[model samples]
Target: MSTVLAIAKRELKSYFATPIAAVFLVVFVVLCGVFTFQVGRLFDRGVADLAPFFNYLPWLFLILIPAVAMRLWAEERKSGTIELLMTLPVSPGEAVTGKWLAGTLFVALALVLTFPMWITVNILGDPDNGVILANYIAALALASVFLALGGCASAFTRNQVVALVLSVVGCFILLTAGMPLVLDAISGYVPTAIIDAVRSISALSHFTSIARGVLLVPDLVWVVSMVVFWLFATVAVISLKKAD
Candidate 1:
């Protein structure tokens, strides 16, 4: 645990040192403001809820999460730091956990910056705070899943650009796995139960449900499980690469 925390601290500090972190935050804040005021037209709605904001989360995360995670392992490998990192006493699991924690913290920070939107809604109307809280919870879970997937994707390549592209494509498939288009494309031959299972495993499936203010335990469990599974897979891949 200490080893993991140490790695996490280092990774988080690295993010702050790079211009990418500042750019990411600025872009997020600006996009959120534009989406809420211009695209969503919060004033026109005259509502206290953040339904419009939450509705755009999956799409926002689909891009941002991959960008944030693109450098996790790819940059290390590109700079020959992965070998140095492997020489440390830290196990593969510790390294993966630490990086995951760091990325998750970055996502948390972005989410925190969105709190002003919450405040705006509060001042405008009496919204259900519980639902809003759930929306945030759902966002955290979705971020966790994407970051883990991105981390795993990063582990496979040394080029950050390649990592980013692969991560986004992979994450997009995960996000849209349950969408009507995807289902319709495969519904002809696949069994109903299989299609339903695919939908259940999709990131959008769980995120949209929670965003709608419906907090189901099964949905929460699926997201948590997927995050853990992907992180574990990342550790395994790193271990194998080290062995070779």
Candidate 2:
């Protein structure tokens, strides 16, 4: 456990040591602010709610999580540091857990930076703090799922671009599967049961429900299961690589 945390700390510090983290922070804040205030017309509507920001989280995570995850294993492999790490005394599980922890911490920090938006909504009017808090839980779960998926993709290739593209495509499909256009396009030929099943697997469906302030057990279970499954897959990939 201590070894894992050490790796996580090192990984986090490495992120801050580079300009990428700064660039990412600046862009994420600016884009999210624009979407929440300008595009959502939060000020124009005179509504004291974080509806726009929570609503935008699914899309934001689809892109942002991949960017954060792209370099995890890919960079190590690209720089030939993965082999050096493998030769260390650390176990594979420790390494994977450390990377996952670092990525999650980065997401948590980004989410925290958006606290001003919460304050803005509070000052503007009376917002449902309970529901907003629930939305944050759901958002964190969503980001975890994405991070795990990104970790799995990163393990599959040495190329960061490939990892990023694969994670983005996979996540985007899961995200949009429940949208009207996507469902309508597929529902014409698929049975109702199949379409419903597809929708049930969608990130948006679960997120939308939680954003409405309902945090059901199933939603929480789904997120945890999704992340665990991908992390296990990452371990499998690493095991295979070690065998080779």
Candidate 3:
């Protein structure tokens, strides 16, 4: 546990050691503002809640999370530092978990910086704070899922660009699985059962469920399971690369 924390701390500090942290945070906050105010037209809706903001989160994360995660293991492998990392006392599982933790926390910090949106909605109207809180929780869960998937993709290749592209494509598939357009397109050719299964596994569906302020046990389970599965996959990929 201590070793894992040490790795996580080191990885987290590495983000701030460069300009990546500043650039990512600034872009994230600015995009949130644009999406919420310009694209979403929050004031036009006249709703007391942050539905507009939450609605755009998955799409925002689809791009940004991969950017953050593309370097998890890909950069180390690319720079021939994975050998040095493997020489340490840490196991692949610990390294994967630690790096994932760092990435998740970094994304969470970006989310926190968007608190002004919540404040704006409150001052404009008597929004349901409970629902807003639930949306924040759902957003964090969604970000974690993306981070894990991106990290898993990073473990598969030494090229960060390849990792980023793979992560984006993989995340996009899961995200759009529950969309009406995707479901309708497949409904005619695919079996109903398979379509239902695809929708059931959609990250967007679960995110919407929780964002609606009804955090069901099933939704929580799905989030935790996805994160765990991807983290485990990342560890396995790293192990294979280490053996090669």
Candidate 4:
């Protein structure tokens, strides 16, 4: 546990040293403002809730999460630092978990910075704080899922650009897995059970349900399972590459 925290602290500090971190935060804040006010028409809704913000959050994360996770392993391997990293006393699991924690927490920090939206909603009118909290929970889970997938992608390639593209594509599939267009495309060939399964596993579907303040046990399980699966997969990939 100490080893994991040490690695996590190192990774977290590294992010602050890079301009990318600053740029990402700026972009996130700006996009949230634009989407909530202009694109989402938050004022037009005449509601105190941040439903519009949550509605746009997942889509924004499809791009933002991958960009943030692109270097989790790709850059290290590209610079041949993976060899040094692996040689450390840290075990593969510890290293993987530490990096995952660091990346996920970085995204969480950006989410925290959006508290002004919550404050604004409060000042404007009375809203269900419980529902707002639920949506925030959903956002964090969605971010974890995206980052885990992105971390897996980064472990597979040394080029950050390749990592970013692969991560985005993977997250996109998960995000739209349950959408009508995607489901309809495969519905003709697949059985009803498979389609139902697809929707059941979709991050978007679960996120929507939770975002609406319907925090079912299944929704929580879905998010936790996907995040763990991808994180474990990333560890396996890194281990395999080293053996090669």
RMSD, one per candidate, in order: 1.4, 1.8, 1.4, 1.0
Question: How displaced is residue 69 in candidate 1, in Å?
Answer: 0.3
* Tens digits of lDDT, candidate 1, 1-244: 9999999999999999989889999998888788878888888987788888888878888899999999999888888898899999988889999999999999999999998999988887899999999899899889989999999999988888888998899889999998897899889899999999888888887887887778888997898799899999999888887533
Number of backbone-clashing residue pairs for each candidate, in the order shown: 0, 0, 0, 0
In candidate 1, the residue pairs with backbone N, CA or C atoms under 3 Å apart (3 or more residues apart, or in different chains) clash, namely none
Cand. 4 TM to true fold: 0.97
Candidate 2: 10-residue stretch with minimal lDDT: 235-244
Residue 107, model 3, lDDT: 88
**Where's the lowest-lDDT run of ten residues in candidate 1?**
235-244
Candidate ranking (lDDT, best to worst): 4, 3, 1, 2
Q: Which candidate would rank higher by lDDT, 3 or 4?
A: 4
lDDT, candidates in the order shown: 0.89, 0.87, 0.91, 0.92
Where does model 3 exceed 4 Å of error?
188-190
Model 3, 1-244: lDDT tens per residue? 8888998999999999989999999999999999999999998997877888889989999999999999999889888888988999989989999999999899889989999999998899899899989999999999999999999999888889999999999999889988897898899898989998889889998998999999899999999999999999998889877734
> Which segments of model 2 are wrong by more than 4 Å?
188-193, 242-244
Model 4 lDDT per residue over 1-244, tens place: 9999999898999999989889999999889999999999988999999988999999999999999899999988888888899999988889888998999899999999999999999999999999999999999999999998999999999999999999999999999999997899999899999999998888898999998899899998998899899989998999999633
Clashing pairs in 4: none
After aligning candidate 2 to the native by TM-score, how far in Å is the CA of 140 from where it should be? 1.2
The whole-model C-alpha lDDT of candidate 1 against the native structure comes to: 0.89
Highest lDDT model number: 4
Reference-based TM-score, model 2: 0.93
